[model samples]
Target: MTFESHGVSAGCWTGTLQSDRRPASLSVTHRGAVVVQAALREAGPGVWAVSAGLPPSVIDNGVHSLLLVVGDSVLASLTLVAGTVAGDDLLAEVAQLRAELDLLKREFRRLATGG
Candidate 1:
């Protein structure tokens, strides 16, 4: 079995699961949290699209163990690293970079015009 870490958003995440066995059901459970039933859709043979929602408070920037259960057995167990869950820091950094780029553009224009 193979899985992809799709990052996190609003205490939820969407990822893809691939296995040789046709999945009957899908669910995710985080440590000390309730089991979240994932909404699964088959994308192709042995490929399942999944989305799981975690508890809001449980999404703080940290690593969490997420167990993927399919049918009556545990299919895959993995760790989800939550970084900038809301992406506030990332957005702020992007905005800062944009501002710096704008300043650099203005400086270049002034230099080229010799003004």
Candidate 2:
């Protein structure tokens, strides 16, 4: 995940990017824990980005989390922000898995028939 900004802060994980620039303040939480926090900065307009380098284990298990706070107030918060599992990459992986399953099924059928 890659986040770029001139003043805003963003959080990225699992191929999904979550950003908040309402007041130029942003916070990121993972598994109900705060991971990243960035203060607002004036950069002419408003531009900022945050990227989270998620480990393979996290992705394989399919987990996500997010949290935002503004002056002791919860502006936005979400848990399990799972993106499209049928996306291009996931689709390709699913296709491969299906093909393998098909092959195994064919082999099993053949063995059963022979027996």
Candidate 3:
């Protein structure tokens, strides 16, 4: 299996899977726990574009595995890093606060100037 994107963002991952033999089903897991059942779309002959979403319970930032299964056998396994860094999440919060502060500043200035 070849992945177009190696990272998971917004709880989802998109990639491509190539195989001579198509699997009956595909699934994703984190720390040996099943997280999502993935669906595949044929992009070309013997190639598929796959997308899967992470389960809400697996919230920690770390590496997770995707298991490609054909019947009872695991065809292949892929790894990915999960969750956003603390700094990134904090940056988003800071941007939101800045917007709110700007609005408050505008309101205060209007009141003080009586305009």
Best by lDDT: 1
Alpha-carbon runs more than 4 Å astray in model 3: 1-6, 61-115
lDDT of 2 by residue, 36-101 (tens): 664443333334333343333333433343445444444444444245554565556557658966
TM-score for candidate 2, residues paired by index = 0.31
Please give the RMSD of candidate 3 to the true structure: 17.3
Tens digit of per-residue lDDT, candidate 3, span 1-115: 4445445678776677787756677887655566778878888988887778866666556544456554455555555445665666656655855896699799889999999
* Cα displacement (Å) at residue 100, model 3: 49
Ranking by lDDT: 1, 3, 2
Per-candidate TM vs. native?
A: 0.50, 0.31, 0.51
In order, candidate lDDTs are 0.70, 0.45, 0.66
Q: Kindly report which residue stretches of model 1 are placed more than 4 angstroms away from their true locations once superposed.
A: 60-64, 71-115
lDDT of 1 at 54: 72
Candidate 1 root-mean-square deviation in Å: 14.9
Task: State residue 113's C-alpha deviation in candidate 3, in Å.
Answer: 87
Better model by lDDT, 1 or 3?
1
